[model samples]
Target chain A: MTQESAARRFVVAAIALAAAAAALVGLTLLAGASPIDALHALAEGSVGSRAALGETLARATALVLTAIAASLAFRAGVLNIGLEGQFLAGAVAAAAVGPLLSGAPFVARAGLLVASALAGALWVLPAAYLEARRGVPEVLSTILLNLIAAAAVSGLVRGALQDPRGDYPQSRALPDAVRLAPLVSGSRATAAIVAAIALALLVTLVVEATPLGLKLRATGLAPAAARAIGLPGARLRLLAFSASGALAGLAGGLEVLAVTGRLYDPFSAGAGYTGIAAALLGGSHPLAAAASAMLFAALGAGSSAMQRDTGVPGALATIVPGVLVLTVLAARARLTQKRA
Target chain B: MSGFFAIALLLAAPLLLAATGELLLERAGSIQIGLEGTMLIGAFTAFAAARSGAGPHAALLAAACAGLLAGAAFAAFAVAGRADPILVGTAWNLVAAGGTAFSYRLLAGATGSVLEVKALPPFAFGLPAAALAAFFVPAVLEVFLTRTRPGLALVAAGDNPLALEATGGSVVAVRTAASVAAGALGALGGALLVLTVSPTFVEGVTAGRGFLALALVVFARWKPLRLVPGALLVGGATALQYRLQAGGGTGIPYAVFLALPGLLALFALAAARGRGGAPKALGTPAP
Candidate 1:
């Protein structure tokens, strides 16, 4: 728990991560791939050019929001893993609202944002209630809610929000006015990236610099202490869940409004899971979470290149963050054990 | 109706297999949330092994071994270092997915042939081997838990680790062993899926059945006898989707069929948690 031990733990985690990557490359070689080609493809895909950078940033935009959302609740000692469900709730809401709004772009965007956040909070309400009153572990209820939300959204898209073309199990496209304008000329990156950055800053400010933030952290660290000091434990926990849900929903809404332009049933695509790693990697610090989200986003971008050039499945890239998270958790545990 | 019953049994086989091991592991106080990943790794390993000309029996063995290894690896983080089970479990899933997809592409590159492996030949009257296991594994587990000392030790690991340790039991050993066995069973479920049903490996093929089994554990309240009803209910709901598709039923969306079990499980959670029953020391690593 000392600074020296923390540093040592960080070094060990970094080493473990490097070893996992090395093992992955070795596995790729066993699969008949050239190590150089795989590495090159990864590099080229993530930061090789302006377009690739744009794509990576766009993906990171969503990841940043979700990771911060995760960090917020986790810092409050709540493992709110229902970000995936909450993400879907937001996306579906945005997709639905996009079609409802008429001429004014500002009104449409504002309405879509509120709708997404409201829907996200609504999605986590049941789990929050259960955890608060029934003593249900948030991990269990949220995961169950994730499956249900996925199925519900899939059903909604297929039945009511089906595109007129009817070729895919997806929602109708948003109008041009409702879409976030591209920040870069040739890439998918949009103004949402700026939104993500602003939100990250705001989150850091709220979580680190505010009295409420102190209360939330105290609630997580010592609920009894917080309660003795007149803080309402259940209410604070519920607020954290609701706020996290809103942020997760905003991430989903941003993806629909900026990147996909339509609601894809599987659009969340494990972002919720990925965001957890990102948050943990950042030590649950908002800015750090955003940075790690970008790191994961690059990994995701590089993976597509790996898939295209090496014929390796893009999912291979997802393994790196997973490995990082596992190593980090293990290293932290070792440190804590040793300290105790 | 008999055909429907038969199909539902087939549907329930993998879930039945996977949940039994998870039940054992949980009984021993470690919640291996990575069962889905374990199954995926099993399915892929079995498929790869079978494609290389291993017999179905050999394939199943390979799958179980893979599952055990995967489970042990997960436990190394979950039980060894006292990490969060959800975090460790999620990592295991990613590793399994990436490893399977990476290997599959390498082996089955461009112009890959549709390699078929031998399916497990059914026993009496086309009842697959898995169907037999599905029918009886619960009973075996039930008897094992109630009639054996080791089983009692496992239960003690879950509810009273300190007491068990005070009486000369090693909580870590019990949990580690239970976790590995659980992984092996989940892998067996994966093997059962490819060998008896699909007879092929697909990326992400377990399709949340492993996750569904987690709910089954909760729904059954950790009782082996109750698991049958829990697994079958989900299977029956899934089977309904197939029946609706085959019947050309109008106005019924497949999504409803898919979400049916999920909704049912959610309600079950609500009902079951009226008392908040689970092993007391579950997920808490022993010193």
Candidate 2:
């Protein structure tokens, strides 16, 4: 996509979002709530306080990582739909490995990150193999795998990994050493936000400056041509898939270290899926993905407040982001046609 | 033996229904990955309608209509509006899930107490209408597709829409109609899910059956006849595990049992190589 078209899409998205917001206000009225109050509550919950701001940043940090992973795979001509499964598996793997590492502090943290990344990559293996060997659609396989992971996560947390002392289906708490220290006291925010931003910068540089990035983009843009010219398209795809998995896994790792202190059922609040939305919203560009992730995170962080202040229910909370994405898609429909 | 067959058919009912419609949609060169979302809508509407005094027959119709509407909304963006099908489908999934859950909250309260209703009883020979429909629909469709002119036209549209357009067929019309019909089938699956196995509706009760149906289509090589065994295979995995869990708490984790069908589908897809039956222009929207 050219810069002009990208900007056009953004403009369309902005208009669509404003329309959606108006519709939401109308919805709040139908539900017998004060729309102005609801908006105020949403604003307050997202960034009104230091703690609220910190939480939003923390959520944004994980979203940015996952979105970057998604955009990377998409740029390489592979739709890595297995990120949900990868994220879940990565979270579980981090929890499993964290307690096992009793060595040096830095080594333990790095070990957690690496183990999560590997677990995520392995989780994506079956989908990758099916596409590579059997021409099976990766989209279907990955989606199925995500369903399996959903069922499996609750089972693992409740059965094998459950803390014996607790009645709930949650893992044992992470030791103090395994947890990432918070950047802001009295809030969930941690230095992972910095890491996420840094990673986005690094990804931007890699995609724009590196030969490897060029090859991946080339493969995505024209797989047939790349193969005709002997670009080892297959290997590049596999590499892209693995890298996507690793990044998704890293998001899960940060979630465990910086947000959740241990493995648990419902490990993520659809963070993996939202990553896809973030990538699309950002035009699949790394830095833009980070920005969009923050936007989504704010929406997410404020949803609860929208419910609490207006009696709107959690459904309205979920509907807003979905409507936003749908509107964006609607707005860009014309631009894509023009490009075609 | 009869009981086992009944259980298999019961589990396969939803998958079979959705796969049938999906075959037609695929034949018309459109893939609606939003079937899961559409199913969720159907499941909720059917349950709500039933709870609000609709008869079982009416409930099923309501579900199917809801599915059709949901599917149409999806196609408006996916087919007409020129959005990427995958993304549109994913967004639809989230919207349906959230919308249904939200609706339940508004109607049932924030507590989300399980809404109970009597299970729709089996008909002749102790089998659900869904199960019977599964058996007969494919047979009827197989004949209709093979013998009918419209079926051939649908196939032509899928293989090469541009050519079909040249031949005076409206590609958009065929795809949009197929998408709507497919949504109805997806809703039927969801309605069957709540009406048969469970006496109450729960969030995400369809689980991943919609996607499993998609996988079945792939495994069947887009052939409706082949989908029977494919549906039965997955349905059996799901049905048998529930029975196993009910019979006794085996030492195995329940999650492993739940995930069995997914693994089964993955391997089945891998083993289904060289079938080569996909419509050539399936995912590519018109320029």
Best by DockQ: 2
Off by over 4 Å in 2: A1-7, B1-4, B248-253
**Model 1 Cα RMSD, 1 decimal:** 2.3
Q: lDDT tens digits, residues A1-340, model 2?
A: 2234546866876786796688678667766778888878778888988878887888887799888988888888888877888888889888888877877767888999899899888888888888888888888888988888877887788788887886988888778976888886877788888988899899878876799988888898899998898899999999988988888888888788788878887777788878877877676777777787888888777767778777776566556666767777777876767766
**Residue B193 of model 2, lDDT score:** 81
Cand. 2 Cα-lDDT: 0.81
Task: Compose the digit string of candidate 1's lDDT tens values, residues B1-287.
Answer: 38787767787889988988898888888897778888888888889999999998899999999988887887888987788787788677777777777777776775556666799878855766656766698899889888999889989999999999999999888898888889999999988888877887777788778888887888788888888988888888878777876786578776677678777777776667733567888787876
lDDT of 2 at B284: 71
lDDT at B273 for candidate 2?
74
B33-79: candidate 2 lDDT, tens digit per residue: 76777778888888899999997778899999987887788778878
Model 1: residue B127 alpha-carbon error in angstroms: 2.4
Candidate 1, which segments miss by more than 4 Å at Cα? A1-9, B110-116, B248-254
Q: In model 1 chain B, where is the ten-residue run with the lowest total lDDT?
A: B268-277
DockQ of 2: 0.63
Per-residue CA lDDT of model 1 for A1-340, tens digit only, reads 1123457646865876686678668755775678789879888999999988888988898799999999899878788878988998899899888888887888888889889989988989988877766666787778778888788787778777888786798888989888888886878788898999999999999988899988888888788999999998888899989999999999888888888888876667788878877887777877878888998899899888877898666777677777877887788777778777
